[model samples]
Target: MTPAEHPQPNAPADPASPAVELTPAAAELIRVLSAVHGPLMFHQSGGCCDGSAPMCYPRGEFRTGGSDVLLASLAVEGLDEPVPFWISASQYALWRHTRLIVDVVEGRGSGFSLEAPEGVRFLIRSRLVRQPAS
Candidate 1:
């Protein structure tokens, strides 16, 4: 898809079939992200059967595309570098309740890891979202 094309919002996400609510938090996240550069792109790549979920990166960085949304300035602590995220309050709430940790990665070599108490571990990769040319 071209830059103008974007995926429909919060549609049947993937394998999970969990109707993703474009909650206020998510909306805010979108809004905030759009302001920095290109439209935010949410990507999911995992097991063959496991449908992907919504995870936004700097627009145009991922192969897929995403709809336009609002943006805000929020800081996630514990990160070595500052990451500007556009997210809704409800999404943030979900992260809080779910104990999900969002992180910012600089390049192919760096990122955070998810260590769940139940021995569930996820190695999250990081990529720099390219800035659109002037």
Candidate 2:
């Protein structure tokens, strides 16, 4: 895809804490997939079927745009570049108050996701963030 066709991950401030994280299992799986696919990225669109799950794709394979939000840029050991995680703006809207934890489980994900062929799928588990009362 043309560079102009895809949305860039936001260079958001380096917050004191990240809003997203990956499980060790998930990071290992990502390492394997990245070795095979080169670089990779993640996006959750809150669509239908597999859309509810976080989908992994070869970096830039999926086109993101204004409707998407950059959730985090995760640094996994053994990977040269940080894997950017994104979410549909609407999904971020509904989930803004939560911390997203990405995990892997035995199952099939979207046919479009790079992990689908590996017999495992990537999923997200979230926890509500408790903000200090103003």
Candidate 3:
């Protein structure tokens, strides 16, 4: 899909939902990366270098433990199972009330992220979730 072709937002995703999302461009790129790297996953760390940019890795490359929270599983084409998306437990606390929109931008991001070699980066845009009326 071309950059103009945006991925359809996953249905039933609302501010109250913890499931993260991927833009069409982001999904398409993931498909391409998967072709070369096999299954993929994402982790948003509360550290430097990428500045909270979502880091993509081959499944099982990055170990997730108690400090990380599995926020969502994304279904992308070319992959048999949904890709897992995680955030640092500490970061999740700060973003617990928001919805994360994962997107792709043109540039080399963290070298550790597989997509970095492709001259593209995965970043997240978040918005606060509106609490229900009390």
lDDT of each: 0.32, 0.80, 0.78
Q: What is residue 70's positional error in candidate 3, in angstroms? A: 0.6
Q: Write the per-residue lDDT of candidate 2 for residues 14-34, one digit (tens) a residue.
A: 335568888999999999999
Better of 1 and 3 by TM-score: 3
Off by over 4 Å in 3: 1-18, 49-51, 131-134
Estimate TM-scores for all models: 0.30, 0.84, 0.81
Q: What ranking of all candidate models by TM-score puts the best one first?
A: 2, 3, 1
Our model 2 lands, by Cα RMSD against the true structure, at 5.6
| Over 4 Å off, model 2 | 1-15, 131-134
Clashes of each: 17, 0, 1
Model 1, range 1-134, lDDT digits (tens) per residue?
Answer: 22112243322223232122343343444454555544444443332321222345664464432332222223323223333333333332222122123333222222221112213222222222222223
lDDT tens string, model 3, 1-134?
11112233322236346557788999999999888988899988888768578999999999998788777888886678888898887887567667889999999975599988888899899876654223
